[model samples]
Target: MKPAILFSFTIFISAFLLFFVQPLAGRMLLPTFGGSAIVWNASMMFFQALLLLGYIYAHFSIKRLGAKNQSKLHIALMIAAAVFLPLSIAPEAPQWDASPALFVIQTLLVSIGLPFFVLSASAPMLQSWYFSSDAPDAEDPYWLYVASNIGSLLALLTYPFLIEPFLSINEQKWVWTGGYALLVLSVFGASFFVKKAPAAEVTATAQTSSSWAERGLWTLLAFVPSSALLGYTAHITTDISAIPLFWVVPLALYMLSFVIVFARRQWIPSSVWVWLAFAALVPSAYAILLALLEPVGLLLGIQLFSLFTLSVAFHAILVDRKPSASNLTDFYVWMSVGGMLGGVFNTLVAPAIFDRMYELPITLALAFLLLSMHLPRPKFEPPSVSIGKAVRAKGMQTAFSVLVLATAAVGFVTYMQSVDEVFEFTNTMLLIGILTPFALWFVHPILAGFAAATVCMVLPMGYQHQNILMQMRSPYAIHEVREFSSSVGQFHSLYHGRIQHGVQATHPELSRLPLSYYHTSSPIGEVMAIREDFYDVTPVAVLGLGIGTMATYVRPGMEMTFFEIDPQIEKIARDAEYFTYLERCGEQCKVVLGDARLSLQEQPKGKYGLLVLDAYSSDAVPVHLLSKEAIELYMSLLRPGGYMLFHVSNRYVNVRQIVVNTAAELGYVSYFQDHWPRETKLEELMVNSSEWVMVGRNKKDLELQIFDPRWEEQEPDGRPAWTDDWANLWVYMAW
Candidate 1:
C-alpha cells in the first residue's frame, strides 16, 4: 500500500476503537449506576484525561526519539495493551450509592485505561510518522485528521444502529479485541513506509513551537464545545431516554465538525459561520433558560443544530491557527486539556454549584462571545461630514440605547411576575431576553454577546424560583418539590427534570392515596389491589422509589422493600416537609439505596411474591432494566406463583412494547393496560394516565376477571427481544 493509504488506514482504525468504547462503557455501567446520565459524563472525563496523557506522551516522544523510534515504542505499547482485551468491568464494582463519578473513573481505569491510552496517541503519533514519510503530500499531513474523524463518526453511528442492535455486549467486546489486535499489526506494517532521511528533513523544515498565547487560545476554543456536548446531552437525555443512541448522536456530530473544518474545501463561507452560530444559539438558549418549549422533538432539533453550528464555528477558527505538522502534537495536547477541563466542570463543578440546568446556556453564551469577536468589524471612518448628520447619528444612537434599557426593564418585571405556565407572560420575557440579543448582533456583535450572557444567567434564576418549595441537585438528576393545587385540594409534586415522578396531597386522609403515575385508579394501583386480594404475595419489591409513593401499597401485615438509586431521592422521601409516604409505611416499608439491579441480586432467589418495576415512567428510563437479562434477573427473585409489574408511562419511548415483547419471549403470561381515567373526570383528583404490564409464569396466577375491563392479556407479536447483548431502543422511540 502507498504511504498515505497505510498511515490513513492506521489512524482511521485507531480512531474507530477510540470512540466505540465510550457508548459501550456507558451501557455496561447503566444498570449498576441506576441508568443516570452522570455515568456518561464521568466516563467522558476519564476518556478526555487519558487522551490528554496520550498526547503529552506523543509530543515528548516525537520530539526526543523521532518518528522511527517512536513507531517502535508505540507498537510495543499496543502489543502490551492487548493483554487487557475482551473487555469487562470488574465484578467488585462500587454499590449504587457509592460516590458515582469517582467510581466511574476508578472502574474505567482498571478495565480499559491502557488500551484507550495507546489508541488515543495514534492520531497525533501516526500523523507525525506520516510527515516523516516521503509521500508527495507528506508536507501537509492534516488531511489524515479528516480521515480519523470520519472513522470516529462511523464508529459512533455503527454502535447504536448496527452493532448494538445485533451484537451482545459480550460479543461486542470480543469484536473490539480483534479490532485492537488488527490495529497493532496495521500500525507496525505502516511504519515500514516512513523514510529515515525525512526525519532530519522535517526537523530542518519545521517552524518554531507555537507561542504560549496561541496554545491558550486553542485550549479556550476547545473548552466551549466540550462543555456544551455534556450540557446539551444531559438536557435532552433527561427528557427522552439516556440510551447510547442519544449519547452517540451529539458526539458523532461533534466529530463531524472537525472533519468539515479540517477538510481541503470550505463548504460554508467563513464570514457567515459566526452569524450561523448565533442564530442557532439564541433559540436553544431560550428553550433551556426559559421553559418556553416543552416538546421533545422541537427542543432536540434546536439544541442539536446549535451544538453542531457552534462546534463548526469554533473549530473553523481553531483550524486557522493550526501549527505546522511538527507542532501538531502540542496543538492536540492543549485541545485535549481543554476538553478534559470541560468534563471536569460539568461532572464535578456544576452539580456542586448550580441547582438547575444552567451549564448549557452558560456555554452557549460564552461561545457566542468568542465567535462574535471573530466577526469582520465595521470600519468607523471619522471623515469630513456635515455637523447635522453627525448630530442625527448621535441622536439615533441615544434612542437605541434608551430602547434597549427599557426592554431590559420590562423583561425583568415580566419575569418576576412569570408563572409556571409557558405562554402566561413567560413567552413575552423569552422574546425580550433571547431575541433582543439576537437582533442586536447586526448592530453590535460584542454587545449582543454580553447581552446573551446576562440573559442566560439572570433569566433562569427568576423563572426557576417561582413556586419552587424545595430543590436539590445531585450528580444524577435535579429534584424539585413544587406546590400544585387540584380539585382534591392542596398538594405538592415531585419532579425529575420536566417529568413528574410522584404527587402527594397535603390533606390528612388524602396523603395516603397514591397520586401521579401510581394513583388509585391507575394501572399500577390496580395491580397492587389485585395482588393483595388474590395471592398470599408477601414481601413485595418495588424498584425506583420516586417520593416513595409505592410505599403506600404495603398492606398492614405485609412488608415491602423499595429499591431507590439516588440517595438524594431517599432523603427527600424521608423528609416530613415534602412527603410522608415512608413515614406512613413505618416498619412495613424498607428502603434500599443503590441501583435496583445490584440491590435485587442481594435478595434471595424466589424471595418475593410480587416485584414491581417502576423506573421506566421517569423522564428517562433505565434501558438496562428492560432488557431480557433484566427480566430473567427479576424472574429469579420471584416466587413460584409470583407476579411482576412494569410501569411504562413515557412520552418519547414506547417502553410498553419492550416489556410486552421481552416477557412474551421468556414464555410468560402477561397482562398490559394503558389506563386512561375516563369514567370519572381525571382533573377531579391528582391522577395521570398510566401504562403498566404484569407478567407471571402461570396463566392461572395472572387470570383476574374483575379488572378484565382494563387489563388485556398480552400475546407474542414476534418483535425481536432486547437482550443484555442487543438492545436498539431508538427503533422503539416514539419519534
Candidate 2:
C-alpha cells in the first residue's frame, strides 16, 4: 500500500480506539455514581489529560530515538498495553469512599493506561514514521488527520445508534480488545515497512522544531472553540437527561470542523455562511437563557443552533491554520494538546474558579472574536459618484445599513422588556424577519454579526405567551420559575437536558407535598409511612428533592433534611409557589445542599430509619453514589434492620442488579415493588412515572436481598469495589 493509504489506515484504527473507549468506560461507571454532570465532565477531563501526556511522550521519543528505533519501541509498548486490554479496572462493586471525580480518573488510567498512551501517540507517531521511511513523493501525511477525525466522528455517531443499544458492556469491552489487537498488528506491520526503507539523515533544524509562541496560537484557536462547545452542551443538558447520545451531535460537529479546516478546499465561501451563523447564535442563546430562567421547550433548538455556530467558528479557525501535509500529524498533536487544555480549563479548572456559568458567555464572546479575526475583508470600493454605478453601490450599501440599524434597534427594545412582560406573537415575528436580512449582509460583517448575536440574546418573540418561572444561577445549576394560568393549575418546573427532571404544581395544597417520585402512592413512600413503627428515627435524610417529592412522605415528628446537588431545583420548589410540598409538610426542612454522598458522610450517625436515593432518575445514574461503598455509608447511618429505599426506574440501563448485588454483599436483604399511580382526569395531573424500591435490612438481611429474585439477583464479581483509589466505568454496563 502507498504510504498515504497506510497512514490513513493507522489513523483510522487509532481514532476508533480513542472514542469507542470513552462511552464504553462511562457506561461502566454510570451505575455506581448517580448520573451527574460532574461525572461526565470529570471523565472527559481525564481522557484529555491522558491524551496530552501521550502526545508529549511521542514528541520527545521521535526527537531522541530517530525512526527505526522509535517504531520498535512503539510496537513493544502496544504489545504491553494489549496485556491490559479489555480494560476492566473498576470492579462491578467498589470498596473505597472516593469522590466521583477521583474515581473516574484513577479508573481510566489503570484500564487503558498503556493502550491509551499508545493510541494518543498513534497519529503523530505514524506520521513521523511515514516521513522518515516512506517515499518523498507520497502525499503529505496531514491528510491522515482528515482520516483520523473521520474515524473519530464515525465512532461517536455509531455509539448512540448502533453499539450502545445492541451490545452489552461486556461485549463492548471484548470488541474493543479485538480492535486493540488489530491495532497492534497494524502498527507492527507498519514497523516492518519503516525498517525496510533506507534511513534518512535527521536534520537538526527538523529536530529542534518550532517555538511555543507560534504553536500557542494554534493551541488557543483549537482550545477556545472546543471548550465553548462543551460548555454549551453542559448548559443545555444541565437539568435534563444527558443521555450518551446527546454527546454525538456536538462532537460530530467538532470533528467535521477539522475536515473543513484541514482539507485542501478554499474555505472563504464556507466562512461566509459561518458569519451568518453568528446571527443565529444570538437567537439560539436567547432561547437557552429563557429556558434556564423558566423551563420551557426542550432547549433543543437553542442547543442545536448554538452548536451550529460553535462548529462553524471552530472549523473556520482551523481552516485558516491548515498545516502542510508533511507536518499533518505534528499539527494534530498540537490540536489535541489544545483540546486537552480546553477540557482541563472547562471541566477541571473553570468549575473551581467560577461557581456559576459565567464562563459560558465568555466562551461565546471568544468564539465571536475568533470568527471576527478570520473573516475575509471585502474588496468593494467606497461609495463614489459615477452616476449609474454610484447609484447601484449606494443603494446596496444603504439597504444593508438600514437593515442592520433596524435589527439593532429591535434587539435593544426587546432587551428593555422585562421577562415578566408579555408581547404579541406577530410583533415578535416581525422583529425576527426584519433582523434576518441585516444579519446576513456582509457589509461591516462584524457589526452585522454583533446585530445577529443581539437578536439571539433578546428573544422577544419566543417568550410572548410563556410564563416566567423562577430563574437563578446556582453554584451547580440554573433554577427556573414557571407559571400556569386558570385553566390548568400552573406548574413550576426544573429541567436538566430535555427531560422535565423535576416538577411542582402551582396549587398551594400540593406545594408543600412532595408529589413526584416521593409521593405516598409509591413503594418507597409506603416504606416512609410505616418507618415510625420500625425505630425512633430522629433525622430523616433525603438524598434528592425533586419538586420536594419525598418531603410529602415525611412524618410530622421527624426532622426532614434534603441533600440536593442543584440549588436551582430547590429554589424553584420553595420560592416559585409552583408546588407546596415543602410548605404542606410544615416541618422545618433543613436542606444539606451539596452532593448527597458527600453531605451524608459529614452528618451524625444513626440519623434515620430510611435513606432515599431518588436523584438518579431524569438523569444518568450518578456513578459515585451507586458504588458498593456508598451503599455501606447508608447502612452505617441506619439502625439495625432499618430499611433503605432506592428509586430505580431508568430508560437506559437496568439498575436493579447493581443495588441487589451491592446490597447483598453488604449483608442486607432487599425486595422489589413497582408502583404506578392511577391516571387522573386532569391531563396535567397525570404524570406517569415508576419507582423500584430495594429494601434491605441489617447484615443478615443484606445477604438475603442479593439472592431474592423479587428484588434483583446479580453477584459482585469480587473485583475491587469502587473506592477513592480506583473505579472503572466499563464493568457496570450490563446493569
Q: Which candidate is the best by TM-score?
A: 1
Off by over 4 Å in 1: 28-42, 90-107, 196-204, 239-244, 294-299, 380-383, 386-399, 419-435, 438-444, 530-534, 618-620, 665-667, 703-709, 730-735
Candidate 1: minimum summed lDDT over ten consecutive residues — where? 195-204
| Model 2 agreement with the true structure over 1-735: per-residue lDDT tens digits | 766667678789889889898877776765555445666677777778778777777766765676678888888888878788678755643333667567667777777677888898887777667766645634355555677788898888887567755676778888999988888877877776564231224443233344577578778877877787777767655643355346667667777867665565654566765665565565555554444434434466656666766676665666556554434445666877778877777766766665445565666655655565556656556665577886687578768776656654555455445433534533464456445534445565565555444544344334432454444554355445455543446566665434555566666665554455555555654555554544544566778876776666556677778888776667666753456667666655777666687668767676675677776664445666877778888888887656677777766645665676667677666666666676562334534467575656644544433343444434445543443223343344533
Cα error, candidate 1, residue 43 (Å): 3.3
lDDT of 1 by residue, 327-419 (tens): 878888898888888888888899889877778777877887887788665544568968888778756764675476467557666666653
RMSD of 2: 7.2
